[model samples]
Target: MTQMRFGQGTNRITGTVVMDRRTKCLVKRIQPGQIAVIDHPDLDEVAAEELVENRVRAVINAASSISGVYPARGAAYLIRSGIPVVDRAGADIFCRLQEGDRIWLDHDRVGKVGESQAVVRGERLSAQTVWEKIHQTQSHFNQTVVAFMENTLHYAVSEKRWFMRPLAVPGMYTQLKGKQVVVVVRGTGYKEDLAAIYHFIKAERPVLIGVDGGADALLQCGWKPDVIVGDMDSVSDEALCSGAELVVHAYPNGDAPGLERVEKLGLAAHILPGMGTSEDVALLLADQEGAERIIAVGTHSHIIDFLEKGRNGMASTLLTRIKVGGKLVDVSGIRHFYPPKTERRRKAPLWAAVFSAPMAVAALPGSFTIDDSWLRMVWLSLRLWYFP
Candidate 1:
């Protein structure tokens, strides 16, 4: 990819427009140096990172980039990365502009080429403004938290009765009994978290469960998910066709929109009827199927994450965590869980260790006159660093 300085332009940009109502879907089609037109309100961190990865020339949002409801930082991220974002561009602009149409962004104004009048004009989000709004929103954090808890409890009461009933789990071919399971989600910093756990995954050989677009994340990292779970909205067709077992999460009313997509692909999927989020279902499934331990990577675990995902209540997640808390561990940044590049009982041969002792001592800082006690002190100090 070429280097990009997003907001360094002359307050103007002219490029082919790539428009999509869904920002996640749009990222797949967007190319560097192309303009992106999206209608996402309260754009979240994941979408912003994806957009940054694509290196779009600029972003034009038909909806508020930061609604000030709770400080969604999509605009801030783009701005900080030097990306110019024109916010609240008219919704009808989507109707007027076609994909691949050349357009012009003149500061706050957007219009098609050769047109004297601008199609839509919105407030340009600058770093100062976005941060100001974010700080202002922070002041209301307590209020948002209180309301969030109240709503969660309100919904939890109604949803608890459903949990009391038995959940009909689909028969799965993939074995989970006594196996360590890694449930992946496309949350903030998921890529980094996955990278941090690379050695742990290689050594332990955990069962990989990708939640929706997280399946694509695994495929990108050269790991094929054993079970792909979600409503199948953000995941790509390539991921769905990766020979992974499809377990679609269905609603309480038995509506399975994701199942329809699976059927269209000629892929067989087991429908899991549940009331909680798809990630919750994935965890509960693994726990019930006898997974010895569940490692959650990028799963939403806090109130802000729930708010960003547009969930007013995390009752299902709350209940599922309570049920599986014994074996569940969120390994988002805990890379030290396992030593790097080493597995249990896989020490070097005794002959190799003995043969290298002299060479190891020779390579140390001290001259050959160094005492044996000093060498031992240094060796002990470096033992942890040599784990790799």
Candidate 2:
């Protein structure tokens, strides 16, 4: 419980990195010469590489798995680079912190006014200044992403398995007809969505399913997924431990590197190696599993949602929509569903019991007197039964 002190004033945030967007991480935010913080637990390698190239001051893992469980490669790399990480709170905590809200690392190690301006102070920030820094950082990020994708694709192609089903396009998966299933995706407000999923499961009892990264969310909530379909990035070790059926999407050329991670986890998972995006693969699994109504928790259908996840193009998604039009029922907004409270009734059984007890007391009248404790118990039961 270390407290941070900040002058009651505002400061410039030149070197500060803001990973507030939950859907897709911002490359510019963690660019070189900036202090980086990830608002989500699941960060793709692409995002991690960008932060590394920039040499960020400190990284705050605002995800639930910040310290309780084993850290992911992204956070691990930051720690290895001598960049301190303080995982004090979840993603929601970022909204309260300001640009100059005096950040203290690891409870009280490195202290600084959490402002981006500190990035370009020469003595503090670095040699790169202004737009050039952004340009160079983005350039490195692009190259890294290309390399990462190539390596991933190579590994995917190397692993050939039966469950691996290659889709015709990305973001397009087969649809199901009548099986009960839930489509779990990473939402902006994931914790809230997790709560909703818990309630939804309690009421509907749908076969809990996770779409790629969402499997990790399910694991966080202590609900083992019945099935998991995705490319395999951003999913944690606990997710693989869920023992749910796994389907890996492969490229048309038969690349499915995500399957390799599944294998590395020492768990046997089904690989539906396909060419589609992870979401598409998930839908395909639902169809293959014969799921009836698909209840999606944090899926993205709108272009904005895709963009937030850093997708440059949407043709694949549009085509996929056309393919699975009927079977898909997006419940992205259903996170607000809460169970209603029980109502009180006037004709409660407690009143009948109360009257019966009084009659019994009257019948035993002239001879003996009932104990006060018994009378109190009767009155209490009457109140409880009569009230909600």
Candidate 3:
């Protein structure tokens, strides 16, 4: 384990174990054997793999939010891989506590700040300053990415022809009749979109659908998803198993890891395979399934959004959007203008009965635990068999 160090006050939340531009960019720039200070302490498997593979030593989570909420998948991956993580006492708070900043990590719960030795008036820290972040060292690497974007187009080639898809669609009015369906996605400005979802849900009782990482975002908001759709890589296993109906957004090439994960968890999923974007598939599912109104959250609507995701082509996405444009509602900022529609709340008892009526008749309970989980999962699958 590396010794703790502190320096300077910046207003961004500290003690988070996140892998952002700061960490990735810094890792590429620093010399072979120097400590890298990170403001956020969160990591996903891919980013965590990068840090460990790079042989960077010691990370200081600068904020409590990294510890308090959301899946610290990257941080957990680091710990599980034998990387040393110094808690909320890294660069963020250390700088703020200069001379006698009084480290207060819940003095009542943990008792007394800095139970370990304190280096008062620590050598003025350098590196890890927020204002000094950069993207890459190699201009060639920058050039390659720029070139990819310059050539990127927004149409899908089908049978030697190209087509465009709409990102938003107007759904059949019946889809929104008595239910709420909120599709959550991971995009730039997602926090803002999440705020919109929070307001929409409070005002309208729509079912929440997490589109891959957006599902994880919903969990952070304490909103359970009614359904989750996407490729499974960015989402956590816990979210996939969170009693939400899983819809595997299969690539036109027939790849659907999301479906496989759902099956592995003994849950049911519908494999909707098409070329285009995962969000596009999600909207199609809502429209095809007769969802009264599909309210999308965290969907990409601009060139920068696609570029950030490394989407070199937007043909399928554009065309998919056009296909579903009629029924889809852009609720990205719906809260600002439309007050949530008021309707009689569906009785909780009805939901309970729908979920429990089958369990009530089963003479044996534990004997069917495995089967129930499996059965509940495949319920939609079976429904597709009959309905399709």
Best model number under TM-score: 1
Badly placed stretches (over 4 Å) of model 2 are 3-177, 336-388
Off by over 4 Å in 3: 1-154, 157-180, 331-388
Winning candidate number (lDDT): 1
Worst 10 residues of 1 by lDDT: 336-345
Model 1 stretches with alpha carbons more than 4 Å out: 1-9, 335-388
Candidate 2 at 31: error in angstroms? 21
lDDT of 3 by residue, 33-119 (tens): 233445553333444555666655444455321332222345555555544444454443444433222232221111115444442
Count steric clashes of candidate 3.
46
Q: Candidate 1 lDDT, tens digit per residue, 1-388?
A: 3334435646667888999999988998899989899999888988898998899888999999877778888888888776789999979988989999999988899999888689889988888888998898888778888888998888877877776666688778999999999999998878778877765676578999999998998988889999999999999999999999999999978889999999999999998988889998899889888999999999998887888888876888888887787899897655445433344225544456556767878787755555678776555434432443
Task: Report the candidate with higher TM-score, 1 versus 2.
Answer: 1
TM-score ranking, best first: 1, 2, 3
What is residue 93's positional error in candidate 2, in angstroms? 24
Q: Give the local distance difference test score of model 2.
A: 0.53
Model with the higher lDDT, candidate 2 or 3: 2
lDDT of 3 at 176: 35
